[model samples]
Target: MLELNFATSMNDAMSDTMIKENPFSSQPTTSAFTEESTYQAVCKSAVASAIFAVLGLSAFLAQMFMLLPILGIVFALLALKAIRAYPDELVGKGAAKFGLLLSAVCLIGSGAMHSFIYATEVPEGYRRISFAELKPSSRGTDAQGFPKRAAELDGEKVFIKGYVRPPSGKQYGLKSFIMVGDFGDCCFGGDPAITDVVAIKIQSDDTVNYGYGLRRIGGTFRLNPSTAASDEEEIPRVFYEIEADHVR
Candidate 1:
């Protein structure tokens, strides 16, 4: 009986030890090494940067599209910053770098090309002029409030670049159109400031298609002959008009 009791106690102690060291025990355990999640999310800004970079390829087409690459550069910087701030949770540093590189290339290359064109675009006999030169005189009321610069250039062959203001549901095969220096002034729905607008009449039976990019025109700059007056105000028909001999 004593032997049986001793064996029983020994077995109980062994069972208790086994229970304490059991590998498959149901009790909660703390691992010395915790596993990390392998999945990482791409930064949204990084993705946007890449997308903008792709769209920025169009920057070569026109200067207006240069904004795409500029936005891409901004978004790429933001993405890189976010990825650095959240190292473990966010990825896409490579994508951000790619976006940055492509955007830089597009911006620099297109900018250089546009600058070159701007430098050499005027015809040999045409004088390069800007919209700023056409502003009315601030000091004197001479030339019907026209600036001296504009009056000097009157009937002179001048080369100017401007955006075509879309017409009111009439854009196809146009012989004439309104021009503005700033893109924001384009109004299909409303008229821009009278002084800021130019009436362009295609000469030599030439016609122009509707477009939004800068149009390089070599023309005879002139003041409108019409000084038609409304009941309340005197209004000159367009502040300026271009008798365009060359359009491109």
Candidate 2:
């Protein structure tokens, strides 16, 4: 009789426990189902790193865009440090790693490609020079003469970049065209201003098509000796000219 009573009590206790745990009966279940995740919040920096890494692909466009990868690396490092400090609270280790990988690839690849292009850009036997070197001395010269640096380079083979000013006669099948130093001067039509223009006569049978932007020319640099002559009226309209061996 006592054993039967004990068995009945045990059955009642089991039923009570089940009733308390029934979710449909307005009772609490195990903490697993009801509790919110403790570490569900993602590390914000890690997200930012992933985003920046995607944008880092722009590095292929130009050398200046390498900044994107640099920023991605920085953000990724910060995210990893934060996650390490709060492992249980934050997530996104994968995002951080991805950011690191892509950023490194872009930074290194762009740097190498640009370096190669630069090393090979200027053809052999040609020295690169900008318009800055060809300008006349601001401190005043002998009758508005070009700087001494320009005189030294005269008759020497040189490489320079300048805009192809719109030709007055023909756009295509041009044997020669006037080149200007500044983009504004070429597009908006600035005066030739003696020091600002370079007359380019392509040496090869390759006649150039007129276009905008800087033209890369490698050839013999010429200084119109008439500019330095005693008579101001003897000065040529364009003070510099190039018998271009290469035009791009």
* Candidate topping lDDT: 1
Q: After superposition, how far is residue 127 of candidate 2 from its true place, in Å?
A: 0.8
**Which residue ranges in model 2 land beyond 4 Å of their true spot?**
1-39, 131-145, 161-216, 222-243
Candidate 2 residue-wise lDDT, 61-175, digit = tens = 6666799999999999999999999897799999999998999899999899879977887889898888877777664444446677777778899998888777765789877
Error of 2 at 220 (Å): 3.1
Per residue, candidate 1 scores C-alpha lDDT tens digits across 130-205 of: 8877776564545466677777887889899888777656688877887788877763444456767778888967
| Error of model 1, residue 223, in angstroms | 1.4
Worst 10 residues of 1 by lDDT: 227-236
TM-score of each: 0.75, 0.56
RMSD of model 2 against the true structure: 8.2
Model 1: how far is 234 from its true place, Å?
16
